[model samples]
Target: MFEFAWPWAFALLPLPWLIALIAGKQKHHSTLMLRIHALAHMGMTNTKVTPSRKWPHWLLAIVWALVVASAANPVFRGEPITLSEPGRDIMLAVDLSGSMREQDMAYQGRFVDRLSVVKAVLSEFISQRRGDQLGLILFADTAFLQTPLTRDVDTVAQMLEESQIGLVGRATAIGDALGLSVKRFNEKSQSNKVVILLTDGQNTAGNLKPEEALILAKDAGVKVYTVGVGADGRNQGGLFSMLGSSGAMLDESLLKTIAEQTGGQYFRATDTQSLANIYKELDALEPQAEQEQTFRPVDALFYLPLSGALLMLFLAALWRQLKQQAVVGDA
Candidate 1:
């Protein structure tokens, strides 16, 4: 729809018409005349010729109308739009043990270690996420924060890339990882916080037990999705160097119990493909509702009317100049 922002300016449109009427009605002085007495008695021929030019006032009035219309500032109305979405905050707990280096899981038709496939697929996963706050926790024997809960996924991914096994030693502390993740979630309410824990081995170090950490998560109202990652027996070759053979073992039962206690489901990722699928499924889960937001930018349209006024003024000026030249030639 079209509308004028300054509709009051339209009232000025009639001013030029009133001025033209007054100017046209003004009286001009009579020219000097001399007459002889005998000429009054003679017969005379009379012919009527109608005047072709009465007024050019309408041209000037139209120019003024254009100027006023231009000043009114017209704009097009925009349509309303609707969008629906859920809101939630998520924290990802990743295991950085040396055993994660085992090359037994198949991904994209090739075999890569649990961590290698995870890093690749999860990086893509993080990129696609929107409107969710995310954080990262890396654990070995001890737990360390790769990043705190944040809305910036790129920072989280960069921290994930920098994670290595030896930062907290070669031991697997599932409890400490959960505890740290829960501690980070403490900053937010339980209903809004969630944890996705991925590990390849049972807990070996940490003050808290798996059940105890789950209790903390339950009290906080934070949901926990536990993912146990590793292949079956003999996947780790005898020639393994950086990671010992013991790293390949996964405590699935403990992970299940933790998830169940926190009102979340546990998942087993025996291969990289299954791990990727599990994360994708988690992405589909709905989050809590958040406050809605909107923004609008205004655009000025005064130039359109101003251009028309300019053209009208130019035409009037040209017509006046041509009339003046013609009068001069006739004289």
Candidate 2:
């Protein structure tokens, strides 16, 4: 549909005529180079006013109308699009600690780093989130809001994809990640706040402790689904307390407790398939709202009339110049 954003601008259509009427009348006095009536005709040159051309005035009127039409901001609006309004506000905190560089997660039968696999699966998940405000937090020694909570899922996905291991530091700050996520959610008014924190290790480095962050999450009413990501054989020993080499890295107990306390769930993603499945489960849990929301795509058409007006003015000016040249040649 075609419409005007500023229809009132059409009232300016008569402005040119008003200005012409007000300024049109002027006193013209010819110089009297005579001593008296006897010498009045002695080499007296009278100034002659050229007759105004009708075409120029008519052309200008048309230009004024076009300019006014342009000022009215003509727009072409496309058909209305009904979409489900975003109800869920999901925050994704992916571990960017050095351990995330571990090639334990499998993709297409080949072993890839945990971060790569997570990016692949999570980007797909983010793309599928049609009507959800998504945020991203990349955490290592601390958590950074890579992308704010926004309906632009592509940006969130791109941030996740561009993340590098140890971009911040070399230690997993799970507590800091959780705390930041909760803090962000509390700043918003949305009731459906969710945080998906994926980590291959426990709270190794950060100011906030995992327990403290868990309490914060619960208090803030933020649902946190913790995913313990890594290959099973590589991580062994204790689920609660610290154990052998890199074995104690994946703290399943702490993750489970965090999820349960915050009325969320914990999943152990031993491989890529399980990681994707975990997200699928989350989809089933917090499905996108099915209610109706709509918007119309609009395109500005003011430029069309505006450019036409400019071109018309240029052509009129050229034509007037050519006509003047022809008259001079005839003279």
Highest lDDT model number: 2
Angstrom error at residue 188, model 1:
1.7
C-alpha lDDT score of every prediction, in listed order: 0.74, 0.84
Off by over 4 Å in 2: 4-73, 81-87, 96-107, 110-120, 130-133, 140-172, 187-191, 230-250, 290-293, 300-331
What are the TM-scores, per candidate, against the unseen true structure?
0.62, 0.67
**Per-residue lDDT of model 1, residues 136-172, tens digit only:** 9888878888887777889988888777657778777
Give a tens-digit lDDT track for model 2, residues 1-331: 9999999999999998897677656421222322353254433755332344666677888899999999999999999998788868999999988777766666988877778999999999999987889999999999989999999999998888889987999788999999999889888875588999999887889999999998898888999999988886553333322333142358999999999998899998888899899999999888877878789999999999999999998988899889888876776
- Give Cα distance to truth, residue 68, candidate 1, Å: 19
TM-score of predicted structure 1? 0.62
Q: For model 2, give the 10-residue run with minimal summed lDDT.
A: 26-35
Worst 10 residues of 1 by lDDT: 29-38
